[model samples]
Target: MTRRRSLALRLIVYLAIAQMGGMLLLVPITDFLISASGMAPGWEVAPDDWGEHRIYGLVAGSVTRAETGEAILEPSAALGAYLETNPQARYAAFDCSGVVLRGSSRELVDALGGLDRIRATTLKFKIPGDPDPRARGFLRRAPAASGACAIAAYSYRFAWDDLFAVAALFLTPHSAAVVAPAVLCALAIAWIVVRRGLAPLRSAAADVAAIDVNTLHRRIDVEEAPKEIAPFVEAVNDALTRLNAGMAAQRRFTANAAHELRTPIAIMRAHADNPDDAVFRRDMKRDIRRVQTIVEQLLATARFSMRDACADVDMDLGEAVLAMVADYTPLVIESGRRIEFEPPSEPTIVRADRWALECVVANLLDNALRAEPEGGVIEVRALSTAVVEVVDHGAGVPLAERDKIFEPFWRRDNKSNGTGLGLAISKTLAEQMGGSIGVDATSGGGATFRIGLRKSVVAPPIASFGRVEPQRAEGSVGARRGTA
Candidate 1:
């Protein structure tokens, strides 16, 4: 998979480059204004020159031109004479017309360099044709053609090369400060625009990725999402709605068909057995009962499995368990298994349907009775917060079969004569009631089946009236008779 570049780093890089670029252009703009407005007297500026300036000063000595493409050397001889006359003649230059023709200041003229290095080469050839305003004023001549550069060259010393070198350094870096912020601002604006524009795409992708078959009945709440993504969300939700409706119709048809077939099977089984054959009749009756249990469990599973569409209310879980126990006592006792129950001291109210909670308890008790050996004990306990546990002393199920026990028709031993749907039905019912059921190892060394239900918020009475009469703490209600 290809990785994406980060928006922040890209923003920083682009902004920095833009800032540096703007600074480059800013330097020339600033140079034009500063040099133009700050011109001084004796400075010669020109029309065709764009933006360059040069200035000159007063005369201290003179030089006469000679004809052999060379100077007469009068200024050198004069300078030698002046040096002899005064030991303190420190620096000098020959300014002629509007330009400096020669100089004696070592730092200035040596940097400008020797006579042959001066391009125009002679005293007569090196002057501007017309003086600029500042130059005309300084020279005191309307036309600067007659003198200033020559007079100033003989008078004072200036480091022209040094002045230019220093100006270039200060000007460029200074221009960067003035222009960088605006360029950075523009780039920042661009980044915000890009990120904001892409937000809808990100949200739509998350919504699409989050969709699943289990949640197909749910639609994205597009009114609460970004406007740009509303249309796509609507389209996806429409597709999901159609798929869910078709699936729901198919399930309804299958359940209805199965239910229709059950009545005919029951009628056929009733006619198949002859009343005269006692043994055959008893076995046929048991088989028919088994088939009836299986059909009832199937119907219950299908009804409760559509949990998302069901509405539940608060129910007394303790009462629900007690009712099932009372109804199943005959069957349990007939099987020769001792069934014991521990009711909570307080009402254990939970959020669930009364019928659903009863079904769950009935299925669990039935499983416990069947699993326990004849004359063995089955214990039931209830607590606050709607928790109930039914335990049985039997050949406990293997660890590997625990998970499979909750799957439809998954019997550990096929010869046990069970429909194998009890636990599976109980699981579905518990989940529908917003609860859970599982088997855990009992502290007393048997398998304890636990049913956990949602706790209620209201304060419950200490008594709720459906409990059986009190019995001894450690002894069965009828231990000698083997009744619990």
Candidate 2:
């Protein structure tokens, strides 16, 4: 990725440039203000040559040749209208030999260095403000081809179009003197403001950079942040909070899984010392089964949460429960108990992942068996509403504990069986298949774990939801002792 430019630096640069540009442009305008305010005589008058240049303009336009080729003044013409009121008041033209020209008297010529100089340059004059009406002015000599020099004086004025003369007004040594030091100071101030204004953002960035798994709980101080970015900082802190929780849960899960596995291994190692004993063989088998159950529960939990792990398919609720009850019957009998199944009154179809559903049902059955008293009949039922219930006459779960039991590694007491992961694994698998499993008090006295299965579409053939089987009604289902 291309590196981003600094916004603070760019803003500071822009501000400094604007200040310098405005200052440079102000020089010509300041001259205009002074000259127009009649203060030109008091301060730097008329920007140094504007009045002298204007005097020469009148001399150039109004001077003309007489029939005898002599320089003469004609202020009454259209180009000389500015002098119409007081033509000779600011006008003078002198011939080379101190001879009085047509515009001004010999007394004015004496003031202009009469006859002593062959040619004359611009010379400053106060030119009385009467009829010319502005206090400050300048005089300049204009010579015609006929060898007559004319002197004219005028006050200054400012115009609107004078503003576009950026190069003429600003590209000067005088403008440079005012602009350089001021621009340097302006730039320095802009840099300082930018740095101080961005201090909070820099602090927030430093806080974020320091965070790792162990420090995720630390948050950026929102009080110090500007309102414009407070929401963004809060969002980052929220993400960190979630990351911290997930990491902590993962660590606890890993440690608990290890501890559960080690206990069975220790039991099996003791059993190996009495290999020939029947009790040792039995106990070894039981311990190995416990280890296998814990491993399977952990595997199911970790993998089922993956997006592609669920293969949802339409299955008949009665048929699936009947199958589960059949598989779990032998285990129930071996434990000196019985299992029963009840089919739905009508065909009930559900969408579920086959492997995930089996694991969930097996976990439910395993949990029931552990809680059931000897010779107790464990019941499996499929209601017409696409629900499966595993009923056991064990101590019913308390209301508060029901929600907690679905959490990983939560158990009622230290004597809890099967790693306390069966219900958690079942919850994970059911949710992944877009189904729900919950427990309530069984009637008469026990825990009733109910599964609300996903509604299945049996009409339109879905290639991924598995093949739909023909509905076959059966007699009241019985797995072992009693008809469910």
Candidate 3:
């Protein structure tokens, strides 16, 4: 505001100076032109010729040109003439020899500063015969005379031109007295107008100052906000919308995880209360472990949500699948099921986080091993570019339950001990590792789980075991059961 005021004042000052300066400069120029042009005879002309103009005319009846450069004039005539011509011109009148004109014309000289009081004076000639009393003041006398004088003494009258010059000069200083007040008034008016123009900015600042975090739900109303701030208001509204969505997602994940944990704990509790049956106790322990597996899967899914898939490294898909299959060897034996691991002729490397890749493999194997009937065969195969398939010879998942199986806390059969987060966690981990989990056709019968990871070009050793070495030929000494 101060800067703006200074600018405005500078503009006003420059404009006023330019205008006033132009007007003041014109006075002297006009005076010089009029004087040089001789537009009108000066007030020193003879009375009869000049007529009854009240303020100007030479004095009548008392003048003689001396023979020897001295002007002899009647004091009254010279003084009156000088007084008449310069009503506006200020002066003191003196005689031909510098004596005061007193007595009858005394009032005129008295008004100008009485002659008796005059201590110092300059001399000039006065023409008593001229109509202009102002010019008669110029009359002056020579100190000595000679025969046939070529010069005269006369008193100086105040000419119309001189009067004009005096008036113009005085007005310059006096006019400023009049002009200063008006300029100040105009400046006050300008300040008011500037304040009015800035009112909108002030009001907008007030509105912004009142906003706070607790009031984020409130919107800046268009009627109350300035038009220039509308975009900022819209952006703030959009941010609030995204924040609300993120909060809702967090709430949903928390609720789902809680529900998923309840089923496993309930199953473990049920099994502990049935202690009398040893065979049933063994089955209950298996179910307890299954519940624990599902809980672990939930924890893994939660952990995966906290990070991104960019952490993935290049890994061999065939090797990861075979390793998971071998880890489930005790379960395979306990269930009286045969398992076989098959990989591509070449190593199928994929870009993925290795730990997440292992989790996905482990979950799928758990699911397959749980569902297989006694004496059933489980085949693990790696297709091109990190695609892994786990197939089990059991009743295939119903079409309606396939998607449901990937939801937390859902189960397809009452007899199963699954907390139902295994497939869900596996699906989430696959996606995080830049892969996908889905169902495919089993080789001949049963359910097949397909996991696809990002493909890489590098191949593994030609005859590497990955995780599973070939079992001894079936029915041979110390041969373990296997299925392909």
Candidate 4:
């Protein structure tokens, strides 16, 4: 890209050029005024014999007696005497009748085509030279003391070369050395002023950059901003205010929706679980349980989506995993699947909300059980103090679909039994707790879902609990009962 010139530099250059041009114009006008005033009264000379001779005047290059056309002084001798006195003069002559008296400069007289070619009025003309030249002349006819016609004509040559030379002085390196510093100083002052003027804009930009969903309440300080930009800043603050209100409304809607659905889903689950007919009870319970899972996932998603929803509580990773696995173990076994828990011997403590961590672990176990085939194994293992992994012996998630799996309402197979929000909620919960969750292919032919949490320095207290084993009756798996 072409670099643009600075505004201050451009302005300085334009102004300087205009100033120099005006100065140059004055040069010619000054010279013209001086020439006009100098030539107004023509050169005069008196000879010793002219007091009684009544000599009127003598025309240049003409020899004549005053008023008689009698030859007296040769034009050459008379012109030589005048030029000897004023050698620098361009034209000087006295004319009487048809005879003309010329200066000693023969070259100038020949250039003006002798005094005969000279007009009896002021005129300007170009002088012949290698290149070009010009001159200005004035002629006047006056009366002498003897009543004879006295004519005097003077020509002033224009010094165009000298004029150009004077003009060029201002365009030289020395002139640049003088003007450049002044221009630069002006530009520096302008830059400092401009930058200071825009300081408020820079501050506003920084404030705008800092704004996010969490800091939506912050606004640009319109009063401190420059007047020209205050309106724009105000508009931006207004937009942020509107956006904050919209987000608040969305959050309220999600919370209200979750709250409104919880009671009905709980009632449905209780009714489905106590049906008289065993087959109807079993099917209704499964459907109601699916609805319950959907409701829980929706609520979890809404809860974790909030910017301020994080609870700064430390939790035991092993305990959270063990509890979730224990809760889902009975359901997994009832569905003809087996669940294995391999928690660490020591408490794996991490900084997170207990409920959010439980939600993430439960969602992972639920997804694993749903993916596993009949008689397949679901392993819940604490891979590290801060990481818990769930490995299932079922068709693993495809490489291309792994990322999409964590998106809300995105199902690979569109299974009616799954809400598709389970993994999404798990991801949100993990992020809210400053953790991460991801899926990978299992070694054998299943998927392994890993959850990484921030490890806590403090260890959690241990509690004793009895384990439950699955019971089989008539080739159908029964719910495991836990005892104290």
Which prediction has the highest lDDT against the true structure? 2
lDDT of 1 at 342: 70
Best by TM-score: 2
Task: Tell me which of candidates 1 and 2 scores higher on TM-score.
Answer: 2
> In model 3, where do residues sit more than 4 Å from their true spots?
1-276, 308-310, 397-420, 457-459, 462-484
* Model 2 misplaced stretches (Cα beyond 4 Å): 1-199, 304-309, 460-477, 480-484
- Over 376-452, each residue of candidate 4 has an lDDT whose tens digit, in order, gives 77777774458888998788999999999887656666333465667877897888889999999999899999998
Clashes of 4: 11
lDDT tens readout by residue for model 2, 51-70: 34444454566666679876
How does each model score on lDDT? Answer: 0.58, 0.70, 0.58, 0.63
Assess candidate 3 and give its TM-score to the true structure.
0.45
lDDT of the structure predicted as candidate 3: 0.58
Clashing pairs in 2: none
lDDT of 3 by residue, 1-484 (tens): 4534554456567756765655565654565456555675682233221112212222323334446744444435544555566343323224434454322244344433433333333233333345655443321222232111111223333244444444455366678776677666765776676556556556655655775654545554556545765676667667766666555545655675466557656766776788666666667767677556756765685675676454777776666666676677766777677777777656567888878878888888887877777767677788755688888877787787778877755676655665566787788888877788888556566799998888865555455433346464331111222233
Look at candidate 2 and tell me the lDDT of residue 355.
84
Span of 10 residues, lowest total lDDT, candidate 4: 45-54
What is the clash tally of candidate 2?
Answer: 0
Lowest lDDT block of 10, candidate 2? 460-469
The TM-score obtained by model 4 is 0.43
